[model samples]
Target: MQFIINQISSFLKPDLTILALGADTRQRVSWTQSQKIYSLSPKKDLSDIRGFYFQAARFLKRAFRLSPDTITFDPHPNFVCKKEVDSIRGSYFPKASLAPIFHHIAHAANFGIE
Candidate 1:
């Protein structure tokens, strides 16, 4: 959390923040009272916290005047609909180019992504 605060503090007055989200293997499960209890039991996988991560990303984006875009399984594993990506795109950068950039692969080029 401190890392996020530091990031927001360092951004220029006007800057872009791209936040992304994805579901982990653990999150690809059904939610139940037992699951909640298990989660609180400290025996649940921390990997299941995908939802919170996305939530935090959104929070930080707003705090730093940034934009958020998330990625998730196209045919989501645990849900009937797969719309987070399109929702984010529509809400944040509706007019921005919808180019498919291999972001992770371009971690050293211009802006750390060509």
Candidate 2:
């Protein structure tokens, strides 16, 4: 939880936050949002904390400047990530836009790879 607190301390008022939810072997919650240039993939399988993560994500959206229409997710239909993302989106940001992007693409984009 200390890490979360530290993260809060950092001045990251993101305009968008992408939830990297896929690649079954390692179900993580990552983000490569705009307007605050940073990426975060907590060192744990966040799929287990689906509820908590969304709650916090909602908070991030409300508390910080995170955009309301850019809650993204993976496009892989079979991954549990999609289901949870649907649930989170429905329960939290129902009107948010879908910005589907692959996990590999996000990672590769980090290093300027196309």
- Give the count of colliding residue pairs in each prediction: 0, 0
Can you write out model 2's per-residue Cα lDDT over 1-114, one digit (the tens) per residue?
211322222233555454444344543344445433433334444545555456556655565545455565667776555667777767666777667777677666545411
Worst 10 residues of 2 by lDDT: 1-10
Model 2 CA deviation exceeding 4 Å by range: 1-34, 40-49, 112-114
What are the lDDT figures for the candidates, one per model? 0.32, 0.52
Q: What's each prediction's TM-score?
A: 0.33, 0.55
Please report how far candidate 2 places residue 66 from its true position, in Å: 2.9
lDDT of 1 by residue, 1-114 (tens): 222121112222222223323234323211112111001111344543544444443544465444323232334434322434455446543543332334243223224211
For model 1, the stretches where C-alpha displacement exceeds 4 angstroms are: 1-46, 49-53, 68-83, 91-95, 107-114
lDDT of 2 at 44: 48
Candidate 2 at 35: error in angstroms?
Answer: 2.1
Q: Give the TM-score of candidate 1.
A: 0.33
